[model samples]
Target: MTKIFMAMIALLYAIPAYAMDGTAFLKQVDRNLNPESYESYRKLINVEPDGRKKEYTLFTVKKGVDKVASIFLAPASEKGRSTLRLGDNMWFYIPNVGKPIRITSLQSVVGGVFNNADILQLDYAAEYTVEKVEQNGNEYLLYLKAKTKTVAYDRLKLYADGKRKLPAKIECLTEASMLIKTIYFKEVKDFGGGVVRPAVIETDSPLYKGYKSVMIFAKVKARDFRDEAFTLTFMPNLESLR
Candidate 1:
């Protein structure tokens, strides 16, 4: 049909070519996925091989590409716990502990496949550089390399929806390209105010063979915050922002 042919033609052109700038396209995808500054509520669930599950809800805020903070909202034990990230430096605060302690990118606040880097994630363009882009049917596959050794995943393979420019799946890898985990993004929903993207991100890792983690996003909104809100000194007051 003529309509189908036209749609195919449009997709072909939309797909990144050798002449297209990979970094620019990646940045576009990052923006399409989230605003430069925003607030969101996420329910993180961890599942075990025995079918046991644990869930925690968080109120997250981001000020820029480098600053992000989150506070746990549910489960009495983690309710007052907060985490902050200013670039590569991260800290976790517990109400009783009173002082913020440094944490690593690979450590998990909510144990499962997702680590600190994934929980307090910055913009993809902030941490990664596109090494190459390829078109796979209706999707665009992006090969990403971490700009620094401190990055959690040294390599990433991202498959994005060509039409929406949003990631459909991501494979996290080590320096040698060994697969660490696979994250699948699904259930796209519109959160309004120009925020529309996947609401569910489920992840599994071979390293944690019997474990899985999922992030369910809700009420995501585009908004700006103060840089101080992303500091260790502000971790205890993170809940006040919401």
Candidate 2:
């Protein structure tokens, strides 16, 4: 009995206490990806099974935890179109529409596997609560649950690199545990000014077989913005900030 008790205690001590705090580690991963407030330029590419592709370039600005806005920069048809997210509310502005329309996180503005939620993504820690964490070889797998029903995905399985503390891959699932999509992060790069993270993020969904979407980060740097920059009226002039 004494030996069995000692063995159990040894096993418990084998895992570090800090590693057990999944929430703290999740926040670390979020900060490692980007600062709390920053601006970035990205190119989103959607490829069809027939070897055809469509691309859109965007300039995205985010402030704090609840405000994020993005404006399309390329493709004449999509130019001047903007999207804003203020907490749970989201709006889409089109040049010809003349007014912003309410949109949902599940809708895709660019028409691909990547949805609005992915394009104007907030900090992961903002929407998810870490349910548990496990160490697998040199990687850490984090299980996350959505904080509200409005979130795009109800659950997520995130695998992060142990050394770099960056997400390697993520599995987005429904509340019923149905697999929706898998996202892979690759091509780590240094964007200067203490910003270093994956330059490429690729995602594919079982619901849309043979279709893949890739987002490539061209530039990401820390920059502050005014509260007005994330409002509906200011969305039309988002290009001015660039």
Candidate 3:
């Protein structure tokens, strides 16, 4: 009779630990998404079908808790080209144009493929709230809701690797529950220092067929960028980036 009572006490104590599963999982995923510690990486991007490849040395720096700035230097083809993001705004520098073009945060990032928000290094926590944990085989899925009017998609469903807890796939849904984009993460690797980074990301839009963008991170290394590198006034310095 005493053993049975002890076993009942143990089971009652385990309830609190089991209840922490959702919050614990959310915090773990958030830690991986925080870009503050993952300052930079050497990137290689390959656009599909065309078999085109480009290389860039990249840098990421956090301005505050909800703000991050990333810089790209593609010396091979896009030499002297610079892209900057401050909060929700993005700007580009073209050597031929001799000026920086201000790209609004909502301009739908036009380039190889994918929407502007997908490329913009914005604060994910501000825009989305995650919940409704579901497990299917080896994957865990969560429903993310846009918290503000400024967001592009109304909802996003994310599928994460069950064992690794890294993002595996993301599905975007419109305000009316229409599907818009589906992004898949492949070849994810740890970028050292406990950052689980996605090496290859392939984004596909439902509006376009036979069109997709595959970003491959060939090398990832920690880096430091001066404050001047992330400023709008310093956008035209191609020679200084090298």
Which regions of candidate 3 deviate over 4 angstroms?
1-27, 33-35, 42-65, 75-77, 106-110, 221-229, 237-242
**C-alpha RMSD values across all candidates:** 4.9, 3.6, 7.1
TM-score of 2: 0.92
- lDDT of prediction 3: 0.62
Arranged by lDDT, best first: 2, 1, 3
Weakest ten-residue segment in model 1 by summed lDDT: 13-22
Q: Write the per-residue lDDT of candidate 1 for residues 49-107, one digit (tens) a residue.
A: 99999999999998778998999999998999999998999999999999999999999
TM-score per candidate, chains pooled = 0.92, 0.92, 0.72
- Measured on C-alpha atoms, candidate 1 has an lDDT of 0.91
lDDT of each: 0.91, 0.92, 0.62
| Cα-based RMSD of candidate 1 | 4.9
Candidate 2 scores a C-alpha RMSD against the true structure in Å of 3.6
lDDT of 2 by residue, 1-242 (tens): 99999998777644544546889889999998998899999999999999799999999999998899999999888999999999889999998999999999999999989999999898899999998887756788888999999999999999999789999999999999999999999999999999989999999999999999999997799999999999988888999999
Q: Which of the predicted structures, 2 or 3, would earn the higher lDDT when compared with the native?
A: 2
